[model samples]
Target: MRRLGSALLAVGMLVGCGPGTQAETPPESAPSAEQQQQAPILTTTNVDVAIECSGILEFANTASYTLLDRYLPSNVVTNIVNRRATAPFTSLADLSSVPLVGPTRLKQLEGGARTMDFIDADCVGILDGIAISRDDQTAIVNLVNTIDDSELHDVLPDAWNGAVNLLNTRPFTTAQQIADTAGIGDVSFRNIRNSATLSRPLEALFTAINAIPSNGSYGATTLRHFDWWNIASANHYYRDQKECFGLEPTSVPYGASIRPNLANAAEVRAEVQRAFDYVGGNTKVSAAVRDAGFANLDALIQGRSFKGCILTYENDPWSRNTVHIYVDTVNGFSVMTETWWAE
Candidate 1:
């Protein structure tokens, strides 16, 4: 809610003053006689100054994606794109007749389209905590609340009322009111309030920040840490683990295993062979073949047994990546580390 100031004055001139209108006229002696003698007397007319309130001003971030998904279903969107590529619609009616589209839906879609074409089209200005149109200088602030009902009743509908409420009733102004109505105290209300008073667009900036990963090594992981390559790598490991050993992380207890103890070297070698074969045979191993190799290099030094082995690959090098494959005497197979390089 940035604030701007405006002044409106309606200037008019009083014509002839009759007997009954004498009281309304300024005293002749108050100013110059010449001024009073003027046929049209100057008078100030008070006009109610209204400020236009727009929903666009209220949006902490644009709702372009939301509007797109709502109005343009997948099929409709695909059809529209295809139509645009092949041939343009001759009329609005032809465009509206697309499948999964009705009059109401079409109107919403058109509004969104217009908003996209002219960035400021959807913006409505608010004056005195209410939405007002500049053309008629009429306040539609209260009408904003009825937007939902209007949609159902086939009237002029506003989809931005929720956005308006979010702006006007932001936590800064309405926190105390909300707490009071909800039978809570000011301290509690203040604790949960998310109203930001930053002069810039903090919310949109934060959204961008949240999308990137905090890890410096990886380019950028998602909030879910399911980056494209990570997902592909995980799927590869998951498929091999399931098919070769008939085992899954969820099915096996942490301290238990399919086999009671480590089998003989020959049996371990067979399992290692199976793992290598599985990885090698899979043509869709995302990285280079050299990057996908796995090996078991366990050996005994002195009397101590070296049970775990490192699976190294050229692309996923020791400097940047490490994959630790362990064979527990008690728990059989365990993947200790599967990490990627910083590049």
Candidate 2:
């Protein structure tokens, strides 16, 4: 099982981050002692993410739908929305009194106050990697994958320990199952069910790239030396093939060490040089890789990914906004920035 079983409330959790994007920033405060105890201990369900029931407006992505159906079902989501037709929900409790939401669901609602695991209803990306759509709704933006436990601490410090502890002990299949068995507040479950997926928000993105019918026209990038999109596509197939089976996702480790045969060498070279810009100074990136024991650019990226070669800066230096890197690892040349699942 994945170490972050708790990180994914759904699917193999988040996958395949885009290049050039930054990692989630670390927080100013550690989670309060209280929050550390209540966070949801979750696992990927490889389930389809339900649509957004933003409560602010009828979702537009689906021409015929208007609410999320992953948690319970469409009829139920519709009922809750219909009841609150006049206003947006301020909290999950708005539905606590609804018929289907009995004491158990209510408990989930109450828990929202202490801990949350889903994307905010206001968030703009697809949720939990399910790819389900809410009618008329666009996907959320800047959504971070919550599947990485180390990253989770900054965003939800309160639940970080719970997520970690749970991940260490068990592997779960559904958010509802985790909530019921793990006692994650019912509301937290609702948050995950209601929120956008944390999985790599790039399926549509990569698909669009592959569909470009690139017999050669679509794969080029300005960076000049490499095929960024091609690498991303290769990375996708390597990771998604397993996710297609619904098994726990095995993370693609940073390469055993940078070596000449690495697939994403071009992009890795570009980013390693770029790392010097943010961190500052002519020798920053050089020093970074050199300190790690490599000197020249080719040697620096020989068997590794940008993950090890670049210095992690305060502003989510982990993100590669324009390029994705693949390393020679278990997932077999998978990128580390985002999450992906076989839909």
Candidate 3:
């Protein structure tokens, strides 16, 4: 059950989240009536899930360089992997294209933990979202758990103060629900993207921690599915109060330094506007159709990037000739493509 002043319960100031969505930019998570009506079955475990998902690069493509360097056939690493730097392997499937990630090696990767759950989907351009299975709890928790309590003071004040209260509440299907509720800001999300983690099998990790529950606590239960906010939020993140997506100060340079390709966020936003404006002006598109496109863009741009960021792509099937945008502030960078024709 939720605490007395939990953000969700006390988000009395309702404000529109944009043009399309039902949730407002207040301290309330966006659970539908059905979700709210259903009583939550909370599970508490003294055991913590040891692993999240693979780190940024792994989600984008493969496991860490060290893992690949050690695991892949020595011949393959020398002939195919080492040269990838100059060529830049975009996806794990590209390994096949690179020539040495042959059938035997691919099979090895499939059975192994190092390269197992990489999200390598086809992308025509900038990816809009990253698809992660709920079973891949590691990645979901990794990104969400990165935002620290200290930062939340300004970034998500409501969440920081009411962390315990919020956890006493129900499940969240999407991080956006919590972010939208707390009215999270851009600075917080960006600061958060800089700190993330990963790499360990879910089953083994659970088995290890769950071997014994602590202090008469119930065993921990995690979500079956948790999508990256295409944005970020702490409320949607903390499955339990003790975990912060490992948000404490860290010294891991690789995860700490990763970021998206956009050189400037403002420039990217301007380009997004110009693309939509051009689509809205298309004579071939009916006035109603054109207006409809703008409306979709309005909701997407406003709400889509609220938690994370919106990625733009060229020749997207979503529009006739306009750009297709992907809103992902979830995994920091380089997971994989989750393409959608959603206008």
Candidate 4:
């Protein structure tokens, strides 16, 4: 039940819409009406980020051998786990005590730590408010205790009346109380648990938005607008196919036929801000939240992750160097920009 579910795909329209690290100015030609119709629908998946810690030290205390192996070799992972079993780690220095976790690997772990989540109840201080079902019962309890009635109902449409009543009671001491007080059946309770997955907070979304570099290497600039061709081309490619762009074969198997367009950094950032607001339930951007799967901004963001891919133009003009940004959203809201040429 803790595993990620299938990414729900809905065929929806592409609406158009970055910079920095800087790419060459792009030439533009609008897509034909028929081409516009053919543009790709934004793709969506249930956001399910894995648990991670803020730093290597925290990871040492919490990560199982399997998770540790992601950062260390099996031998190193075994040593770390065994060492921790005998004496818990109190700091990063302790990791070096484990065989094979040399200074180089330790530094790599330090860098990788930023990408991980810290869900250990004993370790998580501020992050305790965020919850996923896989975390201890306390996380589930916190979720049921804190979620908005409207959001609860949205996640469990079948239990609307119960959801409102569940919210009114306030501060349920245990996760089980949710079902008991609301009269929501086992099915609804399971729905609540399943929906409890959320890895980050609302603020993290802004952090990611701000993190889109002003200039990326490989002629990658902040994306300004995604033309109809980019939209249609991107739609034809799935995450892996697009990700494979920089590797070779000159063209994507997904059938993307044109080079990407890059433009003004400020304009692209502004558009991304608008997209974030629209997705976050800020009605100023749109009357409705674009995706029904998410009850609110928090719902969309909790388990979400953003991925970027590099497209190189080494062999063909059609294969212009570009960066593609993907978010787990109903509209795909995907956009691209030219990047520096890749070798």
TM-score of each: 0.17, 0.26, 0.20, 0.26
Go through the candidates in order and give the clash count of each: 8, 55, 24, 28
- List model 3 lDDT by residue over 19-123, tens digit each: 233431112345444223222211111111111211122221323333444456656645553444444443334545656665456445433332232212111
Per-residue lDDT tens digits for candidate 4, residues 1-343, read: 0111111111111100011212111112453342232212111223112122222454454444545556667776667666665555543445666778765666555444434532222222211111122243455566677764434654556666777777778687665566566557645654555455332232234344434443332322333222322432344222323343221243233643333432233433444445454333243223232332123343444444332344433344333343444332221223343443323
Q: How close is candidate 1 to the true structure, as a TM-score?
A: 0.17
Stretches of model 4 off by over 4 angstroms after superposition: 1-136, 198-203, 206-343
Q: Give residue 307's error in model 2 in angstroms.
A: 14
List model 1 lDDT by residue over 168-240, tens digit each: 5534322223333322232222211211111012222222333434355532111101111122133222112
Q: What lDDT does the true structure give each of the candidates? A: 0.28, 0.30, 0.30, 0.40
Between prediction 1 and prediction 2, which has the larger TM-score? 2
In candidate 2 the C-alpha lDDT for residue 266 amounts to 69
- What would the C-alpha RMSD of candidate 2 be, to one decimal place? 21.3
Native-to-model Cα distance after best TM-score fit, residue 213 in candidate 1, in Å: 80
Identify the candidate with maximal lDDT.
4
lDDT, candidate 4, at 195: 50
